[model samples]
Target: MPTLSDHEILTELDDRMQMFIRRQEMMFVATGEPHDGHDCTFVTGGPGFVRILGVNRLAWPEFDDVSLSDAIADIRRDPRISLLFVDFARGAIGLHVDGKAKVLDDDAMRRAYRALNLDPSLDLVADRRPMRWITVYVEEAFLSAAGELV
Candidate 1:
């Protein structure tokens, strides 16, 4: 087993980080612009909402809600984004990923997810439906323990 040194930031998702991601149902996303500022939004889904495509890759769908349009727009312009995943149910174990993102339509997301049925959880999108996916190329990843952050 590999041990995480203090204050170390990983460029790829280690086994523990991957496990954490698989259990998380929600994440907070921060997208920024060069001059203006940043927008922080919450993304929610059912089981396995976030798919780990590779060691440094993650994929999550975006529904058709107009409220999310701005986040997509920011990604298009800057591609620099930060994501925070915290599991409060389990003493607030957390993961933070900083990456560049690209927007993909439904078809693209399906192909990337490698399944015809890209389930973004039913109830959340049952009526509105997903419009696109935010594929992130993680540049930095950090893990936070139960009581203290690392």
Candidate 2:
């Protein structure tokens, strides 16, 4: 049977949800390896960094170009990810996005975003651009009052 909490879970992000996500400058991403282990870290890219590919899709660039980051490696191997977008501006509920992810280069990532009728505005830096981008196809999303940004 479906419970009230289950009913509160949103399959697609609403306008308000989109706005909140866009306003966030940083978000925590979690990924795991195929065999074992988990990786979670914070990523930032100014406001509107996490692009909304669709109601159930999101993408962000991986800016650490020098090293093979654990999160990146896990995503490549497992593809499962969980993104937490918290509200630093207020003590509000955090938005959770659980999904499968893929890594793409600049051109490919842009194409994918365009295919969804989205504008990959790529305002990351003026001189250099990110070589890799991680796109998530969200499977589930919900808001949690537990990790409120106080």
Candidate 3:
């Protein structure tokens, strides 16, 4: 058996990975604090809801109705987070992204929203317009195709 190191996992998003992320409509987010139990939630949106901000950064909007207080609180205390995206319909593959996440303020949220340049033709649900944004600074990314992590 081979051990995996941080260097072995991809830190930047490649073209194919970016496409995979953009096409997925849902993602599972996991967060935990040092002494507290972990929380996992599923967030769904239009096809391109999550956007890649940079090679090592990604941001996703949080709608008003969704309760992310637990996750947000955990992140504030301990920034560690993991996001999982699976191609259920097409490729049947999954990607695991581990990073530090921060809840962005109004200004930052607006900026991130605008940066996405979403298509006007797409009818985004009125209520889903992002009350806030969570930006993840990616540290390590593992692809299922490479191998299982545990």
Candidate 4:
């Protein structure tokens, strides 16, 4: 298969692709580290609005969301990270994104938080505060072969 271009990646994320991602409940995020590792988190959100929360200055979401400090440090150390999404349904397509990610906590992030009703934990609390959000700047993305589907 031919490698996809930046434009192609965005096109794949159109309405249909977003639906595919949301329909599934989980995805895998592989971050760069000294030993290179993978973290799987419930996709707690849909496209255009993914979230990760924290306390103090560290951002950790559901034990899976990589710490902002760690992620940023990783980016500085190595900006190569890949996110893998697979659909369990039949004839399902798989999406793989190789990109650089950064933590975003600006006005845009605040707005995103308002639209979401998420809890790092299942229990609801009267007073809860979030830490930060990880904004993935997708660089390369594409579909995997059918054989690769699981």
lDDT of each: 0.80, 0.76, 0.76, 0.49
Candidate 4 structure quality by residue, lDDT tens digits, 1-150: 244543245412444444455455556667766675533333443332333231111112322244334555665566666677776564656777666666554445557556555543431222443454455655556676444322
TM, every model: 0.83, 0.82, 0.81, 0.54
lDDT tens readout by residue for model 2, 11-53: 7787777888888988888999968788888887778888887
Find the candidate with the highest TM-score and give its number. 1
TM-score, structure 4 vs. true: 0.54
- In terms of TM-score, which candidate is stronger, 2 or 3? 2
TM value for model 3: 0.81
Residue 90 CA error for candidate 2 (Å)? 1.5
User: Could you tell me how far off, in angstroms, the CA of residue 87 lies in candidate 1 after the best superposition?
Assistant: 0.7
- Model 4 scores worst on lDDT over the 10 consecutive residues at 54-63
Clashes of 2: 0
TM-score of 1: 0.83
Model 3: residues with Cα > 4 Å off, grouped in runs: 1-8, 111-123, 146-150
What is the C-alpha lDDT profile of model 3 across 1-150, one tens digit per residue? Answer: 233753347777766777778888999999998898999988887888788888788887665534688898898999999999987665567888999999986466665567655443342565334566789999878677543323
Whose lDDT is higher: candidate 2's or candidate 4's?
Answer: 2
Better of 1 and 3 by lDDT: 1
Q: What's model 4's lDDT at 134?
A: 52
